[model samples]
Target chain A: MATPVMDKAQATATADYITATFRIRRFNPEESDAVIWEDFQITIDPKERVLDALHKIKWDTDGTLTFRRSCAHGICGSDAMRINGRNRLACKTLIKDINPDKPITVEPIKGLTVLKDLVVDMEPFFQAFRDVMPFLVTEGNEPTRERLQSAEDRERFDDTTKCILCAACTSSCPVFWNDGQYFGPAAIVNAHRFIFDSRDEAGEQRLEILNDKDGVWRCRTTFNCTDACPRGIEVTKAIQEVKRALITRRF
Target chain B: MSTDTSGAIDGVTLYDVDNPAPVIEPPRKRTKKTPKGGGTNFEMIAWLFMRLSGIVLVVLVIGHLLIQLVLDGGVSKIGFAFVAGRWASPWWQTWDLVMLWLAMLHGANGLRTVINDYAERDNTRFWLKMLLYTATVFTILLGTLVIFTFDPNIS
Candidate 1:
């Protein structure tokens, strides 16, 4: 229902609108005693991503600005940060998603060690995955051919394989932040991938592991993790199935 | 030409490969503990709910036990007539209804928390939550139906 003239006028209006500021949280281990916030003003197109704005700021204004980014297209799972008190991928978030008139606050995700400006240490996150033994385990000698799986069997565990290890789900989790030993959402999801897989032989052992007090039992679903996930993974549901599995001793 | 001559000849031996030493590197030590995020005021309300529900559960459970096991000369008194008599009173009906609703909600919320903490994949999370919510709704509806539509006597 829109005409070309109206679209052109709208584009012009968007381009002319210039007052935008980003309030970024900065922490320097060597110089400052505490984390401090600094604001940067830049004129940008409305269609540009928040990542682009950050890049402009780092390029033209402050050379000391630091952040991790790779595969700027959302797949690599890097550049996960807290924007306006929400965990999101910077490259995927457009400026329009946030209030341009207000000072947009950017910070690192909580419950992780901040190595620098926006980068947090992901060692602990990966360590939790390791604790869950997130790999397929087969009973005997290696198969000479591809392991045969039916369509229904493959579909059963299909939903759990889309995790990109962005840590959005894990960091949004209250239990992970509260108790470090709680194996977190991502780890459990990974475990579910193998546990539910038809090719895996370690389902019982993995179930026993997850049945520990601090394992699957610690989840108190707040749905925050589900909301914060950029990949739109359903984190809470997998945990429920795990709970059911523990209770009924069946998938 | 004897063993003593051979030992003397080995004085200038360049290499000895008898023992293989174990290579040990210090374990990778984590520098600092991960920091916990800020707690919002919402946590306080959740804590309060747990305490209140726990207290209510104690009362409901005790009353349930007493009525079902000890009152009116024990289990033999718990036939259709006894149930009908209890349901005839508004207070007893309300009590059972309240217990049913509260316990179901409490258990569901607790389980919901467990799910959020563990499920990782987006689709998995979605489907699993769907299943949980479905089961919870079904149970609640069935329970309410039974409570309100019980027939005292069937000819």
Candidate 2:
């Protein structure tokens, strides 16, 4: 005998009432036990974000559960973690979009030291950013008046300014994961911003710094970084432009 | 102030000598082998290609240079007729076709590897690869069409 299908109204109501199980990977250095993954079941609206579910779990069920969140709007660049085997912001991902009946695997981003359950030490990742000297430098006395720039000049490097300092691109890179010194995609993307800027006179110096063995030359162009960026920055194109610039000596 | 010479004992000049410290050991050289990233196998294949393509490119490029520049009395000999004459022969046609296919594929693959390593957004990667593959397909198709469809004596 065939079972009768539920009507659209009934289906919607059932989905709303269903409780989903989330299997999250947890680790704490202080615990000293082997990495143990625990499951947390929460009754939530399908529209709720994974972050919300996590908060509910933290607030009601397990105070020991830990994760990091700030600017819960995804602008702070915090809350990046591995969900369903891909790097994404927990705040941006909806539980409905993932497998809800089965346990969803959640863990911290790979290729960084795990500071706690879901928080990884972001210092090393930021250190690479600092080394890239993500700043604008100009020679001669500061202009008493505003320095003028053409509209075209501004548009040239406009896309690079969208980076949110999220480690998504860097963590997705196999090369960066293996060799910490590789400037990684995020740093190179920032370098490309100034290297191509018409007003910048430091292009050559930056290119020389990046042309070393650990610099842009290390990029194999795997395109993984591109797939991981939430900001939709064209990191590969920027890197290629940098490579061309280095080869041709044209900033 | 009175300058007094020390009693002229054995005439000796005191000197402080600084010898160059033994040449500081050079920083350890990075191994030539590609770093053992997650994809050692893939890297090995890529390294092999750089060498192999470099070799084939040398031959194909040299022969191309010679035929275009040196053979048949240099640049003036090149015209529609020159290309027709070369392609009329099976051997030359095969050579040109192989060169065309190999060079284009090699360059495209190398570039694809580069794109994957850097593009940071999912949609961006998809669209860029689409563009790359499209261009490669177009060029290969056009080249193949020209190679086989050459008409030496068009009306």
Candidate 3:
């Protein structure tokens, strides 16, 4: 279940409105060659999300302000952007959670080309995801019955399975920001999801794919990915697990 | 206004048929020619070597430091005679040899990863690694030779 925008205790109390300044990095190809910072002042309830603040700015202040957000709750992962110098789902970041007294800086996630104000070219990120062969890869004919797995076996990769592909974890990575060839943390985390699955037969192939120069070895264990994951996935730990698997040649 | 406003911000003139921005390839987009997976476990082995050698290096380095700097009159006793006495034994020679090899390889691999991470261009990365390897090999070989061929009685 989605977490309520405002808890019952807060909802019961008198709503407090505060003026929040959103300093958004604006970019439009038609306007100018250089990117510009555009700040919008909006009075909103502290319990409302950064997404709501953005919506208020777009509707009431300026229609030209561009950003990508869907499912104004956090599930869609489309709203992952750099808020206050950290990757977060705008929908998940509450105005009061971040210091409302200061201006909240919202920019596009790093390591990807910005197509517009806040929309980046997601093709490269998706390509890395595709290269890992994210789906199950069992060989031979399909069985009449479902492939059974114990609950204990299922728990091995449960943390990584929470990934929404928000590009927050991948883009927040320092290595990804510099070396584009290095498969970022998200791809490795996704690979881990299937590699540890009890029923998956292609763990070896996936390990081989990740064993390249641009694979798990590039991770410096900065833990930026773990911090950036809106789903709270332990990204660095999953990467280290993949590295250990490669070393031992075991799942 | 003239039909061609060279660098102006006019809408239609900036992107006409004759004048258009160069289209660049997206970052890290794998092409047909891009090699898929490295068919070898070279990187995996290197990574494993780092951890294993790192553990060994801790013991070797701390022992060396303790003997040379902390034990038996500290830094004052670390003279030519003290060195000669240590090298006279094959055990000390082997210990120094192993320490030299492990520490050099561990450090070289660490630097290599650093270069690979920071150096953006292919030529820059390749040349930086080349320099690192050359220096590492020279130092390791020189240290090994010194350990094996030290004539303690030459003094």
Candidate 4:
């Protein structure tokens, strides 16, 4: 049980600063039939995020390195993209956290049309969101005061309220990719929010809406949407809850 | 942004570029009752069937292989006599009968899921599932009949 001797590690001042390569998928509909990867070499700070590196590349090296972001923090959900083979918020994923040894792969989320380097046409995703009737629906006159709900009732559908409509969960779905008609996970999550809400009178109406051919039945529960969600929502469980609600006629 | 003049969207009046929020639409009403007998819970049952049958199949299939491939000289000991001897016992007969039915149904339903996921056209999906169901039924009937009417004394 003798103590093992440790070798002296090399001392380098630039240890915190590593040279990272970014491989980005580029496509323009009129230009090419397929996508091509463009690589950019950058020296990045360990604490900096992948979004910051993207901004650096776009700002310094290439002006055309296009992507979307609003509140550089994770709240806006505008910066959702594929980073290193997984869907996540670019602003939330640290460059060093993803292993800086190899080239980091950044691309637009799948199951959507890429308008440029990393920006996708979110019209279809939004349309799916819209089709689910995401807003609260009431049958009668508006209440004078706020519609009161119990703490337990509020907790029922609270998990689904984390949806920022990032489209990360929807685009990462195989069913959405194979058959775009399916309402996808985001729509179902939104429906679950209202379907379980105690104050919402139109729960049955929303449930009836979700009872379409492309509605709750189409979700195969592949867990892709659950895995891809940046919000850490239990997407598959919500879908199953909605399904049980459809059968039991109660939430 | 300019009204999507193509009318690709059904209910939206037009696209507003200035306020690009997605236009929310009402959910479509259920056009017809969920067919006649097989009510709305048919898909739910099918999903449940897959999981339940999968768990049972793992036991039945692994036990089947263990006896047929690993017990007392394995496949070499298997022949018409071995099968006839095993079928002689009512327990084995029931075990095999249940296994045949469950396997055929489970495999058929799994392929049905695959076809639903991949088949692009309605006709393609329907016809493919029809072919699968036909094969599964034929195999189940033939296997069940053989298991029941097996003659132990035949040459």
CA lDDT of every candidate? 0.75, 0.75, 0.86, 0.81
Chain A of candidate 4 compared with the true chain A, TM-score: 0.91
Clashes within 3 Å, all models in order? 8, 16, 0, 0
Q: Tens digits of per-residue lDDT for model 3 on B1-155?
A: 35532334545335334544333233354433457776887888888789889999999999999999998899998888899999989899999999999998999999998988888778988999999999999999999989888887884
User: How do the candidates score on chain B by TM-score?
Assistant: 0.64, 0.65, 0.81, 0.75
What is the C-alpha local distance difference test score of candidate 1?
0.75
* Model 1: pairs clashing at backbone N, Cα or C within 3 Å: A219-B113, A219-B114, A220-B113, A221-B113, A233-B122, A234-B122, A234-B125, A239-B119
For candidate 3, write residues A215-248 as lDDT tens digits: 8988889999999999999999999999888877
Evaluated on chain B only, what is the TM-score of candidate 2? 0.65
Show model 4 residue runs off by greater than 4 Å: A1-17, A208-213, B1-39, B66-77, B85-91, B121-127
Candidate 3 runs further than 4 Å off: A1-15, B1-33, B153-155
Can you rank all candidates by DockQ, best first?
Answer: 3, 4, 1, 2
User: Positional deviation of A40 in candidate 2, in angstroms?
Assistant: 1.1
| Candidate 1 per-residue C-alpha lDDT over A1-251 given as tens digits, one digit per residue, 9 for 90 to 100 | 87556777877776655668999998655443246689999998767888998999999999888998999989988988999999899999988879888998999887777767888888878877776778888888888999999999998878789888888888877777654556678888888888889999998777776766556766777888788878777878887777667656632
Distance from true position, residue A26, model 1, in Å?
0.6
Worst 10 residues of 4 chain B by lDDT: B23-32
Top DockQ hit: 3
Q: What is the lDDT of residue A69 in candidate 3?
A: 81
TM-score of chain A of 2: 0.89
Steric clash count of candidate 2? 16
DockQ for candidate 3, please give it: 0.33
TM-score of 1: 0.62
lDDT by residue for model 2 over B24-102, one digit each (tens)? Answer: 1112112323232341234334544665887898899899999899987999889887888888998988888888887
